[model samples]
Target: MHSEHPPLFLKIAAWGGVIFLHFPLVIIALYAFNTEDAAFSFPPKGFTLHWFSVAAGRSDILDAVMLSVKVAALATALALVLGTLAAAALWRREFFGKNAISLLLLLPIALPGIITGIALLTAFKTLNFEPGFLTIVVGHATFCVVVVFNNVIARFRRTAYSLVEASMDLGADGWQTFRHVILPNLSTALLAGGMLAYALSFDEIIVTTFTAGHERTLPLWLLNQLGRPRDVPVTNVVALLVMLVTMIPILGAWWLTRDGEMVAGGGK
Candidate 1:
């Protein structure tokens, strides 16, 4: 038996698309080590770690980094619980509002992020909610939940319900059935989803714009650093650092979800 793949031209086009998408990030990584302080001059004159040290010394950048970490952690934690619950409910039941509920859960990820951000901003304004760290976490969680929900729901669909039934029949209550059978089956999905949620929350800018009041994330801080000539090298260093840190969780999620195979291995 032979595995089939897309046509050569289509494959080339797909790879081309990826290259086009990632080229800027590659360029940024390259320029980050450039010894020259001038504006992104290509084929940099030299390379050094001076800029990395400079980035470390910047007080505001450190604060922004800390703020981003806190927001992403909170958002990821909230997304894990809500997304998993939503996924479980959607997977286990058929009801009158099923489609609508599913659509609403997915809307944040499916819609243009700018639109979601704007709508969330408007809703918050209407509710007279102050923009702050909490607001940022809520904004991020709204979308982050979608990421986790999709992953967990897909895994839940693939899992065998008989195992859960067996557990329940063996004098295990619902919570016990979940703890042993269902939760173990969902471990990989939950891990992958949390990683995805963290990644999304870390770099999100549009929603953060609406929700972040007097709070700067790393991305926002980078935006601010754009205007300063002397800070250029340090900004590059920080950008590269952010890219590396952000890429880890994103790649981990991709690895876990690659084949969509629900890991049957139960936790110890």
Candidate 2:
């Protein structure tokens, strides 16, 4: 009794949902090129690249962008190491408190961002650590690890353990086996996970709000720009840049992992 295609209403609803979600992004993009900069007007008066040039000349914006990129890079690096190791440990192991550990690993990302931010802030204060660049990197890493862990663990599930055994049986040492066998198999998954983690860290705002004392990431800069009505066009340009930076990595991750079932050493 199943139909070959979804009902017409379902299709309409799905498309409508897509548009509803993306329309704001479309408007932001359109406004980024608008010539009239006093305030957003109905039906853009003109389209020009003036705002893009203006944004490029702002030192504050440049500094915010550099800080964001640095934070995201460092956070993604930490996540890659910790997440891969955690996934490797939990993938085929049975141990006491294993489930608890897994849950804790994912807890940061599942909790509301504000809660995580507050918790991280309190922890830093308890440790007498000042909220700054390092704090922001650590806070971002907390959730970024979850992204990498999920991707790497999913890849591990599809990967064949027999390959590891075979490498060992062939007289390869632990490091050699990992380098030749495991790393190759995990390369795409790690890259995809790192990309996703980078994207997530790049646009994060809530956690950054609590941890970034006297330091402004791009998102924080954009949030502050909201108070300056004259900077609407510049804000739109910067917002569009944020979208592109985050979107490219996400799309790259999707492309890398789309055929996830066809993993190396999988079908044996």
Candidate 3:
């Protein structure tokens, strides 16, 4: 028997859809190197690395980048911890309202960013907790946790609980069983989840806006730069840089999670 290929028209449509979605990102990257920086010009006059130097020299941009890095790092860490514990508790368990509990765990990411932001802002105001870096991390973590949770729970379902039992039967303590058996099984999933959580937190704007207050993350800085028309090229350079940074982790996560068994688990 011969394997069938997708129809030519279907292939063209798929490529067209991908190009349509990503072509504008290509445009932004191209304009980042444009010599004519007065405003956007098609077939950019020439290309140069001047804007990259300009972006590098700006302290505000550096600060914003650093702040975004910090927030994303912190949020990813919190998400990994919370998500792993939640997955461990909820996996292979029968309990009351389990589905509802799982739904609540997922609610933050499921809701619109605007809604999440508003709720966070309102809660902060009601509690007299000022919006700032910590607030931003909290807001980002709420959604980031969902990503980590989903990844971990999928892994948990694929894992063989019997291995854990066997480890215990062979004289392994709870910590020893987890350290030797469970941790190895979860390492890749945890890494993938952390990378995804980092990527989401890095580029988040809406929740960041409400919780950031006077704190300027890279996305907020980019938003501010948009108002300065002459600096648009520099902004493009920064945007390109952000894209590159986020792309690595997103691609890494995808690669790590690509194997069915990787997301699923090793045991049957």
Which is the leading candidate under lDDT?
2
- The CA lDDT at 165 in model 2 is 94
Clashing pairs in 3: none
lDDT of 2 by residue, 123-238 (tens): 99999999999999999999999989988888888789999999999999999988999889889999999999999999999999999999999999999998998899999999
Inter-residue clash pairs, candidate 1: none
Candidate 3 lDDT tens digits, 1-268:
6659988899999999999999989998999998854347777888788899989999999999999999999999999999999999998689999999999999999899999999999999999999999999999999999989988998888799999999989999999998999999888889999999999999999999999999999999999987898889999999999999999998898888888563632234
Per-candidate TM-scores read 0.91, 0.95, 0.94
RMSD of each: 4.0, 3.1, 2.8
RMSD of 2: 3.1
- For candidate 1, the C-alpha RMSD (Å) to the true structure equals 4.0
Error of 2 at 99 (Å): 1.2
How many residue pairs clash in each candidate at the backbone level? Answer: 0, 0, 0
- The whole-model lDDT of each prediction reads 0.86, 0.93, 0.92
Question: Whose TM-score is greatest here?
Answer: 2
